[model samples]
Target: MSMINYKYSFTILLAGFFLISCNGKKTENTRENNAENQITISEGQFKENGMELGKPVVKPFTEEVSCKGYITAPVNARAKVTSLISGKITSLQIRPGQFVSKGNVICAITSTEFIDIQKDYAENSAKFVKIKADYDRLKSLREENIGAEKDFISIKSDYNAASASLNAARAKLNSIGLNPANIENGKIYNVYTVTAPISGYVTSISAVLGQYADMTTEIAEIVNVNQTQLTLSVFENDVYRLKPGQIVRFNVAGSTENLLAKLISIGKSINTESKTIDCIANMETSLNKPLINEGYVQANIITAQTELQALPNSAFVKSEGAFFVYILKEKKSGNYIFEKKEVHITKSNDEYSAVSESLPEQETLIKGGSTL
Candidate 1:
């Protein structure tokens, strides 16, 4: 009877243990299933959040900068006209604002010196003719053995000297702006006409219709407005950045009309007074307006050049005064992530900066914070 009691008690204990184990197992399974469901829902919510926020947007790269300059004539050279001889200005053929072609008569002068030149040429020419006749007569006599060799030689010598004197006198006349043919054409006494040395507009005329002028007096000033050039002064610091043949844009002072030009020269020496270096630009075309009144123009010279990536200032976010951009990065779980990237901007222009490193040239950058 004691053995039976023991067996029954053992059975009861075993049954109780089994029931507790099954119950614990069911609870554990239930908890695991509930946790898995919650995790799945959380993951779905995270993905949905990503979709609701929308995909990150990228922007095209651009730059920002500000520069200044002006416009001027491309080719400007001036020539001053002066009288070579003392005389009365018989006629002032050209006045200021007159367009004169090369060799066009500008003014006329009547002078005693011109009269002397013509008289010398005529006297020497007459002597030359007389000597030639004498020489011919002497040569004939020498061939006939009727003239002495010395006499013949003297006649030849006289003839050669007369010819040389005539040539010298004619040259002198030409040197003084007298034409040899004009002297022969009976125009020797005519007032000598001063011709234009270059093609351009007459800028200044000091000679009046009966004004007295001499070698020391300037009769007129001819400016080849076509040869007009521009002179610009740049700061010393910007001087080193200039080069010959760089394109420049120019505008008249207080005028919005602009013209294209190029750098002809850059001053090597610095000005002591202004502490600036002069830069010269040449225009490709001429300006028809009164150029003298074009006034002082501003110049913008490009000194330095470099190619670098640039972005808008808004693309960057400031943290502790340092700049950073939110770069789009892909996570290992196939999710897009925003990773902060630090960049160094070397030089800032009006709208952009010159960076030291090349950004993804072909790739799109994050447009702005709104895209995130």
Candidate 2:
């Protein structure tokens, strides 16, 4: 090869190397700038935009398991008022939603059976008195050796029978809500008073004035609101998170205030149909607002808690499928720069969220982060 041609080829190779080196340097600088990306805004602009900065707080972080249920009364605090005897309802003094006290007259019922029962009691009382007098006289005579033993024995048996008949008659009147002692010979009661068996608010009234009610008929239902309980349906997967005495926050449908309750009992078996366990909670305090039995409720059962670095819910910004928060990086003159740091949220409540990420503890995080 000629010397001039060789020199030219070598120079072309060196120029190619120089161009490759320059391109590589440019790519490295681009990557470095991208890695340190930040947003700079003047302090005046930050204030105009209502941006706020705060520090991460170490607060109690609670993990809650949500469930739905209803308000209910304990079995002992509720009653199904019924008539002991078949009768026509003469008067109903109470209505649904009315408060009633124990032993208070709830209604008046009239029945022919009431009169019959009183009459039988009166007649048996008179008969028993006469039998007792005769039996006593026979015993006296026999003691004086002037009366036959057979006569004494027979009088004794008749007296015993009469006494039993009177007792049975008295029990019948009592069962119908009529005191036998109050029933006289001519004063037979046709109307019997049905009294409230428990002190509570009437939830239902099945009997109306002039309506015939039998023993099987339910006249009314009473529920003691002070003993109201919250029953929650927890699935099997979350049942283990519940324990007696755990606090529960709940809200009834159409109610704005969150009510408080404490778990008292948990069912041992899961419901076959709903695949849930029954958890019963008593109201922490008597409800000032009226709550109906079987009213639907949305509940949050706080299962566990721990101290964690938490921030207000607004501090976390969501983009695409990832969550991020702004960390105050540097401030020069009147300008502030903030760098975005990705975070993982572990738990959250209405106000704050527990977060986990590789972040400096002393760094100031922007509050109301969504505004940015």
Candidate 3:
């Protein structure tokens, strides 16, 4: 009784295990199939959910070349405030992040050279006056045949030389922001004022109080925010595909919002260090926001436009490394039957994508609802 009963019980237990394993495999396969199968949504719910459908329309999409660079001001829009003369910085009227206008005094410096310039101008002015008087008298006498011709010529030469020296000294004073008219025989301009050359916000300050500065010393750097451009570096491989008037979309570092610009020029030479060509783009619009100078940005230069069959960005969803678009298969009773069809994306942009395979002519495609 023991051996026969035990054999029967073991066979029944083995049959039950096999039955449970087959059902579990079937359920798992069904779940996987459901993801790519037909989806049915009620018409009322679809409308409430703001789903839209239309035929695959032919729209323009651009093939883009990815790039990276910085936002920079144009050449004329940027200015370097420098010390035109050598002096120790006595005062600083402006600092970094300060806005200044053209001709505004940026700083005051005390320079012994300014005193020397003034002294030379004063001495030259006095000499010019005396020389001119002598030359005039000699010329008058020569016209009346009362002075020697050699004497008249010698005085004329002296007069011309004196005048030139005076003018040069005056120009030197003017270049250093001292008016010749404001100087007298002994009056000296101890403090020279440096003025801003352009209107812009100061980006950097290199000179501080008590610091010595010269013609090579840059006191500050200014950039006009209203006049800015994008300086992008595109690899030489993609350089030939670029041209003026192409659209450029960029995202500044630390931002995901898209900004737009237009390509204005391409650098003729490639960078030896990077093997990339410099591309200049003018900011077409900023939506009331101004671009910061030297802001790093990642950009896509839209190169070519082609009209192709495509759908809205929301209409396609990526799953398991493939893109699928929802197609309206049929409307039965009150249900909208949509099928998820894998699509071959030939080209794509931020707003649309072009599919290689043409969908059915009469069937409509969902343009908005992909998440459902």
Candidate 4:
């Protein structure tokens, strides 16, 4: 009842465990096969023809191109005035940043030598007048047969010599920035009134009171600031694209708004260092007050303008070597659909340009497609 009965019970328990493990293994294998058979494949199709495809959308574009640059004044329009004769500056009536007109006196010189020259001229002129009067009277008497011909001849010779001396003295005064005729004709006697050479603003002044000024020395620089021209240096390639009379918009380097201007001239030579050509632009409005300094300016010059179908530059997509935009077309299911179309960029400005393709009818192009 003890050993044999215990052995029988242990065998029965071992058999029960083996049967349970076999059943668990069979159920796991069946479940694995069922999972593999559950997999399904569906055919991929394009939006237009039910084939695999990925394309961008396109729509119509109409925009204008605007170029911009800065303001500038021409250098040739400025003038540097110098003295015409060597003399000490006794007085200066004009200062820097002053406006002057033609014939306005800016400075004066006082010289004893000039005084002596004037004295000699006056004496010589008086002698010539008296000598001519005597000669005329003697000649008249001789012609009437009442005076000696020798006397008339001597008087005539004296008159000619006096006339030559007066003429020589007058030329000397004229060369020293004085009008000899004015002195002789009593319009002016001794003092010299130096006049301005041109109408402009005095941008600089070197002539000081009680200083010496010579003919070769510059006394002041007068600039016609009102008639200024902006000179911009653009690359040689950009220079070739610009033409005279092209409208340009430009602003100060740090400004958000731009000013209007026109292309006046383009340089024919290239700058060796910058590899750029000099461009001249005349401001449409007088830049009485410029935002930037002279000598250099940052600018964008307009080279050309044309009409073309174009959207915002961001709407274009680039893949491989082609560019495209996404256009939303209406579908028969009463839902919006997007299609991709290729485009060729002919020209572009900051905001718009010319394109090589037209947009589809009744379709709206997707903007900012590049972000997609």
Best by TM-score: 2
| lDDT per residue (tens digit) for residues 28-132 in model 3 | 999888655778899898888888887777888778999999999999999988888788999999978788999999988888887788889999998999999
Tens digit of lDDT per residue, candidate 1, span 127-234? 888899999998998889996899999889999899999999998887767777766666667566677877887878877788888878888877766666777777
Better of 1 and 2 by lDDT: 2
For model 4, the run of ten residues with the poorest summed lDDT: 38-47
For model 4, residues 191-227, the per-residue Cα lDDT tens digits are 4445677777787787677677667778887766667
Candidate topping lDDT:
3
All candidates' TM-scores?
0.60, 0.79, 0.79, 0.57
Clashes of each: 21, 0, 0, 19
> Which runs of model 1 end up more than 4 angstroms from their true locations?
1-76, 140-146, 185-187, 285-290, 293-295, 305-372
Decoy 2 TM-score against native: 0.79
- The parts of candidate 3 lying over 4 Å away from their true place are 1-41, 184-188, 268-273, 286-289, 317-326, 329-342, 360-372
lDDT of 2 by residue, 1-372 (tens): 899999999999999999999999999999888666577778888888778888788788777879999999999999999888678998999988999999999988888776777888999988998999999999889989997899899999999999999989988877766667676545776678889999999999987889998889999999987788998999999998889988898999997788889998899999999999999998885567668888999998878879877888878889899898888888899998888778898878778888767446655555555766
**Candidate 4, backbone clash total:** 19
lDDT for model 4, on a 0 to 1 scale? 0.65
> What does the lDDT read for residue 258 in candidate 1?
58
